[model samples]
Target: MVKAAAVVIVVVGALGYYVWDYNTSPTGGKAKSEASASAAAEEAKTHDPEVGDCVKVADPQGEPLPTVVDCNSPQAEYKMGEMLPGTQLECASQYDYGIQYHNSRGFDYTLCFTKV
Candidate 1:
C-alpha cells in the first residue's frame, strides 16, 4: 500500500512540474506562438505592391498574399500595373490580373498586375 501511494504521489508531482514549466516558459507556450503567427499574417496582408513592381503571388485563392520580388527572378510571375481604389472587379482592361484587399478597418485597395 505504501509503495502504491508513493508511486501515485510521484506521478502527480511530475505532472504538476511539467504543467508549471510549460506555463512559465519564456515563449509563453502555444498562445504566444499563435499570436506571433497572427501578427505575421497581418503583416503579410499589408504588403502593398506598387505599380511596375514585380511580385510573386503566394496564394491566388481567397485572400491573395503577394510578395515583391526582383523582376528578373523566376518567382516573379507578375508585374504590378495599376492600383485601384476598390475590388478586383475595378481592374482596368489593360491589366491581366487583380488582387483586392478589403479589411474591416476601412482599408480597401486592389493591385493590378500583368503576367510576366
Candidate 2:
C-alpha cells in the first residue's frame, strides 16, 4: 500500500511540473505571443496615414518625409493632426511643423504632416 501511494505521488508531482513548464515556455505560451504580434502588425499598418496618426520623419532638417510608426515607439517624430482641403498645407496648430507629400502615379496628391 505504501509503495503504491509513493508511485501515485510521484506521478502527480511530475504532471504538475510538466504543466507549469509548458505554460511558462516561450514557444508554448502561444496565446500571449500571438496577441502581441497581432497588435504590432495592426500598428504597422497604421502608417498609411490618417488624421491624428503619429509618424516618424526620415529627414527632420531637410524636406521631411514621414513614415507611419508605432506612436509609442521612440522613432515617432510627428503626428498627422489634421487634414487640409487642398495641396496647400498651412499648419496653424501646435505640434504641426512640416508637410510630407504623398505623390503617386494617379492618386490625388495629399499633404501629410510632421512635427516641429
Lowest summed lDDT window (length 10), candidate 1: 42-51
How much lDDT does each candidate structure score? 0.83, 0.68
Tens digit per residue, CA lDDT, model 2, 1-116 = 99999999999999998788767767665657787899998866754667777788666677666677777888777777776554555656464465645456544334445562
Model number with the top lDDT:
1
Clashing pairs in 1: none
Which stretches of candidate 2 lie above 4 Å from their native place? 1-47, 100-116
Listed in order, each prediction's TM-score against the native is: 0.57, 0.44
Worst ten in a row by lDDT for model 2: 107-116
lDDT of 1 at 35: 81
TM-score of 2: 0.44
Q: What are the per-model C-alpha RMSD values against the true structure?
A: 5.7, 9.9
Residue-level error in angstroms, candidate 1, position 9: 40
